[model samples]
Target: MTGDGWNAAVRRRLGLGRLLALGGPEDGVWITERAATSVLGAVAAALPGLAVTSLRLAPADPGAAAEPAVPPPPSALPPGPLRVSAEVVALGGRPLPELVAALREALFTAARERLGLVVSDVDVQVTALLDDLPDPPNGGPPPGPTDQPASATATAALTTPGVARLTAELGPPVQTAEGHVRVEVATAPPHHPLEVARAVRTAVGRAAPDADSVAVLITWAG
Candidate 1:
């Protein structure tokens, strides 16, 4: 890559923040920062007159989390409680405090219910008082090969007790390379994602016994 290209790539990553643990270190599941932001931003945009201008997440206390039995991905932070900082724009009319309070509660609830994210707190920064509501934005991966390790891994992951479904409507739900197994899943509701992810790991183990490592990324909770 050229100097300009490398700088652009670094800036993009800085904007996305880091991979977030879905439940805990023990769960061994993670979601990309971009995915988490999309979830939270959608919740805010749906509210009557508010819109999220920015949304970011970070470990509430990185030092509190001890080393895990399984290491997290190199780009991921260790499992720990997370803190959310969101900047929102709201149209004038309702009290400002009410708008902030509502957005905060909605975001917190969505983080836990929809994503199974353990958020320590949400800090809302009202960036602007918009004169009107902003227009909402509109919104595939390839199909997985039918044979071999990925197919078997996909089957095992889907059949796992707490996995809800494949995480994305398009792309392959499971991918494998050498000894590494990577899977993305939406877990069944009311089940802690950590438990579900751990189970998926076990299932992957049984299905791909020769595999050296498995990584589960939970993109949704229900």
Candidate 2:
């Protein structure tokens, strides 16, 4: 089908399937269904005020010798003049005045037109500049009396789970510039991997209430 055909199919008034059967670019715009969804999603995001009322695509004939690039139909979309905003703030210590302002503006501009919120202002602070650094090659503190010195090979082996072991075998799946807790556990026979991952994330959230995002990765053995 031609570009006009695509427009017509997607914009059809009666049935909605026309929008789903989106055809390739007949007018050098787009043709594939995935491409159509992306285009539609972008338009929707840009215009939050407008509500998408309808969507559909055209149909294809399998018996035809050659298929034409036909768009399903023109789906009804909301007309828009949407507005959205966002801001970033750092509490407590004072951030560099200019940097704080820049961060706020950057966040606001980035989230505008996507999320429908109005941000009046943002506050930022730089509480501390830590002087602590990782230990030098041989200048670190002596091993604690209670600590056991495991062989290098043994340490490496602990990093990878054995056939009977499941759940995380390494450090925390998510690490931040801020502090975080690492957890390692074994699950029973009836546990699901997805459930374990979700649980880990929830636990981390409880442990680090001030973090920005939580991440969880699961590895299994056997």
Candidate 3:
């Protein structure tokens, strides 16, 4: 199987066992893989000129079986150090190496500070480069005052404290139609999903007041 396929199989097998088990004798606490990925991916996607396509987690042991035995109890688990891999398409013009290094650092910090996951390494693959140029002068129509780059919208949403990350499957978070903007996001725990959505709406509204309507979709809030 390909690397991605193998990784997916391994993750499925790990399931909730991937949750980071907290230390101490108090009732066990766990942070789910979904939450960790959301935070890490969001941090990476928030960087200027970078857009994450997908994020994956791999076991430290390459030869580990795709299916493993049942996981141990929370107290028995060790502090895990996992590998994080991301597929991204970045905009041109900026120094690629510097941008990648920034992304790696951001992911590492987010994973460590937010989820207590010791990220052994972050592997970012630049799948494509986005054209940074504006649309050629067309006889059709001039750009409107309300027109804003999707990246800006994304940045605004990420400003919210609890927002873990934006879903990459939906392309850019900002979608414009008839001069209105729609922002989609995924938030981490401790904050209510609706509260996060409201925060995003407020941020986007401030950034793009010209928008006729600002819509926020809380795709995943855990």
Please name the candidate that would achieve the greatest lDDT relative to the true structure.
1
For each candidate, give its TM-score against the true structure.
Answer: 0.72, 0.21, 0.45
lDDT of 2 at 28: 10
Which residue pairs come into collision in candidate 1? 141-171
List runs of model 3 lying over 4 Å from the truth.
1-29, 62-79, 132-222
**Tens-digit lDDT track of model 3 for 37-133:** 6666656756888777777765555453222122222222333456888887788877889989998888887766655555678898988888862
lDDT accuracy of residue 208 in candidate 3: 79
Better of 1 and 2 by lDDT: 1
How high is the CA lDDT of each candidate model? 0.73, 0.30, 0.58
lDDT of 1 by residue, 1-222 (tens): 899978876775564457787776566678767667766777888888787777899888878765544555557777788999998788887688888898889989988877778898899988788788677653122222233233778889888888767654212467667787778777665676667888899998899998877888765544
List all candidate RMSDs to the true structure.
5.0, 25.3, 16.6
CA lDDT, candidate 3, residue 24: 19
lDDT of 1 at 181: 77
Best prediction by TM-score:
1
| Residue pairs that clash (backbone atoms under 3 angstroms), model 3 | none
Q: Any idea how many clashes model 1 has?
A: 1
